[model samples]
Target chain A: MKKLPEWHRIRIIDNPVIRQALVIAGIIYLFWSMSSLDIDWVRVGKGFPRAANILAHMFPPDFSRWQLLLRGTIESVQMALAASFFGMILAIPVGICGATNLAPKPIYLAARAVIILSRTFHEIIIAIFFVKIFGFGPVAGVLTLTVASTSFISKMLAEDIENMPSGQLEAVRATGAGFFQFLNYCISPQALPRYLGVSIYRLDANIRHSTVVGIVGAGGIGQVLAASFSRYDYDFSMAILLTIMSLVFLGEFFSNWVRSQLR
Target chain B: MSIILKITDLTKTYPTGTKALEGVSFTVDKPQVVAIIGPSGAGKSTLIRCINRLVEASSGEVLLGNTDILSLNSRQLRRARRQMGMIFQEYNLVERLTVMENLLSGRLGYVGFWTSYRRKFSKKDFADAFELLERVGLSGYQNTRADALSGGERQRVGISRALMQQPDLLLVDEPTASLDPKTSRQIMRLIVELAHERGMPALVNIHDVGLAQAFCDRIIGLTAGKIVFDGSTRQITEQVLTDIYGEEDWSSTIRKIEEENEVGAE
Candidate 1:
């Protein structure tokens, strides 16, 4: 019988010396970053009791201002829906322009720039900016949600269009169809299901963000919740929190049902 | 017979320095069904695509009934494309659309954009789609989505969609590359029969030499971006196969054709 040569498993990095040096450098960096943070252990120890007191005051949630809570929640829901409608209207053209297969290079770049610009700032910051411009109202909240939703939906939609198989679109083009006609027959049908799914998910996300945007005086349930906290009205704040929780649960259930139906 | 399609000095060189086709040329008379057979990467698919400008030729002239297709601008090229019907290897149907809508999509060039967008095709287009669907043996499948059908059923729909254009010529690229043996023959027969029925010429790219010999009237064998053999099925000797596909034991391949000939003779 012939003797076999010894073998060894291959290393991820072929050079063992460089690999060891990289691992050591990474470990040292992790430890240095961890030790650099300033800690106030004594203050952390005092926070437990304060948190417990807040929880105790939050119990036995009051419903005395149920009508006011209801009105604030309705306003938030209205902002979410209106923003979703307008954002989707804006997103369709922007997504079409952003798709590498569908649009010219210059237009694709411009559309991508717009989406990036919208996504750079957080919704709360944008709401503050809009509040300063439009005064304290639901209008600012609506504008903030619209901008946020447009970027999210348009980016997802452009990726979906880009991932579609080119053969189907090529077949449509071979039929000598006009550009718009080809879009209507070929691109729309292929894109409809994914676009529907993404749009519903974004609407759910927008609803959640609408509540947060109102903390900056943009007019929603969150504003009421924030005011109650400042005034030490913990029970009323608890009622507003419960209402927000129920609304999120409803949005989640509705979005899931719609997505399943799309399938 | 009048010439329905002509190609003169067609060449295609990719940007990466791969020459896919070099100085390829051919012509088809009315009602003729020509089969292009070769090994993989032999420029068979590229030849068919160049005729329709799907893959732009490096330098060539495609004279489709006196108009040089490559010379036409975008608008004129679109008008020129209307006269040419192309079938693909993958049966590239929009999977989410219904069979009737896929069929009606062929008439998009003639109808207004808004008209087709509303799905309000003219009555004449609808009647034609129905008739083509029946002729392709898919009579009651108008409402079925393209993805729901079997492979053979999808190819049937693919053929019907191409015919719906009412084209003057047909360019088929590997129409049977994905089907089982029996389905491949059925599709090949269907394509040739339709071309004859319409009195139009068809250029088909195929990998199966046996099927090509069985269905097509003329065979063009290619190797390494050049045409090595162009003749009838009867003229395909073993030496010719070796020359086109490189040296090999071609006895089994040739014997199959003789057996088919015996069956036909009987």
Candidate 2:
């Protein structure tokens, strides 16, 4: 065989010398950082006693205030339900508008910008902002989760719409269906199963987020957990945490049931 | 002959600067079934789509009946498109929808969004859809989802959806590309028979010369974005086939297919 050409011989990963140097540098940095930061093992040992005390107080989780805990949990679920409902409704239009294949360039760009902006901030931060605007209550929690729901659901939905096969869409348009009319038939049916799946996922995530937002004085079970913790009522805090976990599990079971029923 | 579609100096250049069609001109007259045959990427699809203004032409005039399709506004384009029924190569049905819903989608142009959303199809339209399913040999599959159907079966549904439009002209793009040869012939025969019965003109884009010759009244051959031949199927000589597909070994290709068929039979 003839000698190989320069390009054929030159692979990016063929530079073993540079690769070895990078690995050595990474190892050196890891050891150096560990040495520079002095960690006191005895001081860390003290944290265990406080943890043990809190654990000791958490036994048999007080349910005397069961009615109050149940009310807060119901509020959180209601917030998630309201948010998921409106978010999915609004997301359908927004997602379709943002899909690069479905909408004009400017409209797609604008919709994308809105989705990105909503996603940039965490739900807690959004809740704080809504609390300032709408005043602290379940209203703020609902608004925060609704905005969060739109960001995730709309972005994923837009991606789904974008990734869809163009042949069916073209066939629909060929028969004289307008853009909105096309959505009612082709996009609606094609995206329904996946859309329902994503919506259920968002609903589950929103419920979890709603619990956390309550710590910031947005209404939910998290507020109850935070208040109980601050008052040294670890048993009540344990009860709230268990309730939140149970809620999450229930949502998961429901979402799976809905997915199974789609076909 | 009365001309239903007239193309004048039609051209299409994609944004990437690929010239899919040159200044090509052809007219589809009356209820004649015409076939567009060419090698892959030789502008057969572009030529077929340009008539319906599906692929926007860079420069041209496409007259559907008397109205210049390219000159129509968005509203008028929708009206024009309603008169043209399209069949896809992949049998492009909305996969999750029931067959009846897919069939009713053909009337989406005539009905508004809300009417179609509620499935308020007129009694006659619903009746016609049922009749069409039977005509396409898929009567019992009305409630079945499109994704559940086989390739040939889906194409039959594709045919039903197009016919339900009660289109004046059929725009077929490779109706049998994915089907087995026997099914391919059956589909072509069904399409031709349906068009003949309705007196609807049809422009079919096909890759197989043999299939085109078998079903179509007139054949238009394209090479490198230009029409090299346009005539009756009887006039398509072996030399013309070679010219269209660029040195294609037609005899050998046919022999290989025959050999495959013999193996399949065995």
Top-scoring candidate (lDDT): 1
Candidate 2, superposed: residue stretches over 4 Å from native: A1-42, B249-266
Interface RMSD of each: 0.8, 0.8
- Across residues A83-168, which tens digit of lDDT does each residue of candidate 2 receive? 99989998988899899989999999999999999989998899899889888789999999999898888998999999999999
Cα lDDT of all candidates, in order? 0.90, 0.89
Lowest lDDT 10-residue stretch of candidate 1 chain A: A33-42
CAPRI band of model 1? medium
Return the clash pairs for model 1, or none: none
For model 2, state the Cα shift of residue A127 in Å: 1.9
Q: Please provide TM-scores, in order, for all candidate models, with all chains considered together.
A: 0.92, 0.91
- Candidate 2 has an lDDT of 0.89
